[model samples]
Target: MTDENTADSNTSTGTNTAEEENQSELTAVRYADGSLGYPAHTLGSDGNPPVDTIDLREYTAEIITWTKATATPPGVREPNTLAIVEFEIDDESVRAIGQVTTTEITIGDRVEPVYVSELRDPTAGIREPDSQAWDGYRFKPIE
Candidate 1:
């Protein structure tokens, strides 16, 4: 562990021990931040900062990776679609019209409710109702 103090820099340059001399392509990017090691021509994405420096570990060569963001935002609001509320005999209670806090499930979409009939202990979660449940509820798709 005594050598751990300078392990990273040593491992990164350990190739110096090779018998045959070869040009090395790995070089650390020099930035105001002396810890980052960005590669040449590596363009940073929008809303992200560019890497501009390499940090040498004291005893071990640590490798790092970077990539672009992967998340896509849901599209504009579907005015008619309502987030789920409780279901009753004839229809389900939706987040009422223009309620700021409520987001609704698209009418055709299924969703889980927090609770159903307490006494029956029916599953509160959204379920693909079977033919019997559909027939009992008279479930219909809204235009």
Candidate 2:
């Protein structure tokens, strides 16, 4: 693997190969100050940072810790309690909450990233349970 730090710089026009441009977009935000943001999926509802989407790998995780929700946040009534999970992504760890009914998630369980639709139940009265559905990343244990 070519070390990106030591990779040859285009001393001429200052551009790399065409294949590099076609590769998956890295999950980083370059600041005007020449600093790089964290490489992570912008899948939070907090509206803090990383307002753009980032590339994420699927079916490549193992659960490290999990917490089963005991109570709904405030307004929701009949919504199911999701399991908040922290899992490994390469050497880095990522956290995402996932829906579960019959199966229980445990540490070290092989998990994978899954895109779930936003919970759209009018009866429950919770319009946005977590955040925008497509922006959220959920995980499921590999069967």
Candidate 3:
């Protein structure tokens, strides 16, 4: 992945050009009250509008919990491992849940977001492939 630190040149626009070029970067919402949230919220926890956005790919998060799902939604992988991770940004904690790249993770393990073109086989689902997005980020244990 490209170095996120070098993407600072585009901060004036509130958009990271480096992140835009890197699909692995996870987009997160930044609230006006100085809080961050994943899955990008339309409104803040305090009911205020978002102030800006941040790329979670620039940060490394710690695993809080994990589990394996044997019964998954259609098109998703069976026995897929998922984890809830916490990222510390500006002294605040932002938690998100996503699939793990592998099952070799544990609590307290550090992870980084990696882009997956298709989290599942879209065609394998009941709905039309173009009806919904199939790409997403996955957590990979950091070396």
Candidate 4:
């Protein structure tokens, strides 16, 4: 009999191929301790199209890679979520604390990781965005 696991292993080795295709492909992903979350990258964002992009793969060395195999489409990058992260993929460290609000249906440059998809991930972080503060009321002169 033949070793069942041996022959099949060659094709599985192609995992590297997928990475090659994604090389410099330009995607937006959550940056945590420098490691990236799988497949949760955006192909493009407003004003900035897929034509010019940010290579998240380049930032992988900052931390451990954490994410599912599947991919997500382009949408708003949420600042609120990005703020709570204990670490970031960016070269510099961010000590963020603020609040932000918006319609659930809408998205923008600010993208956030869904709790279900990201909370457990080691590299992921929570958001603590700031709320919009109201201005004091103005007084009117009596006629």
| lDDT to native, each model | 0.23, 0.42, 0.77, 0.25
On residues 1-143, what C-alpha lDDT tens digit does candidate 4 reach at each position? 21111211112243655424433332444443343333334432232223322443232111111122223222222222212221244453322221112212112123222111111223233432222211111111111
How large an RMSD does model 1 have?
27.6
Which residue window of length 10 is worst by lDDT in model 2? Answer: 1-10
Off by over 4 Å in 4: 1-19, 22-26, 29-52, 61-143
Best by lDDT: 3
As a TM-score, model 2 comes out at 0.43
Lowest summed lDDT over 10 consecutive residues: which window, candidate 4?
134-143
lDDT by residue (tens digit), candidate 1, 68-106: 222322221222222222222112111211111123223
Candidates 1 and 4 compared: the better one by lDDT is 4
TM-score of 3: 0.77
Error of 2 at 69 (Å): 1.8
Flag the better candidate by TM-score, 2 or 3.
3
Q: For each of the candidates, give the backbone clash count.
A: 18, 0, 0, 15
Q: Could you say which candidate leads in TM-score?
A: 3
102, model 3: CA deviation in Å?
0.6
Overlapping backbone residue pairs in candidate 1 total 18
Kindly indicate the candidate among 2 and 4 with the higher TM-score.
2
TM-scores for all candidates: the values are 0.18, 0.43, 0.77, 0.18
lDDT of model 2, residue 75: 38
* Candidate 3 collision pairs: none
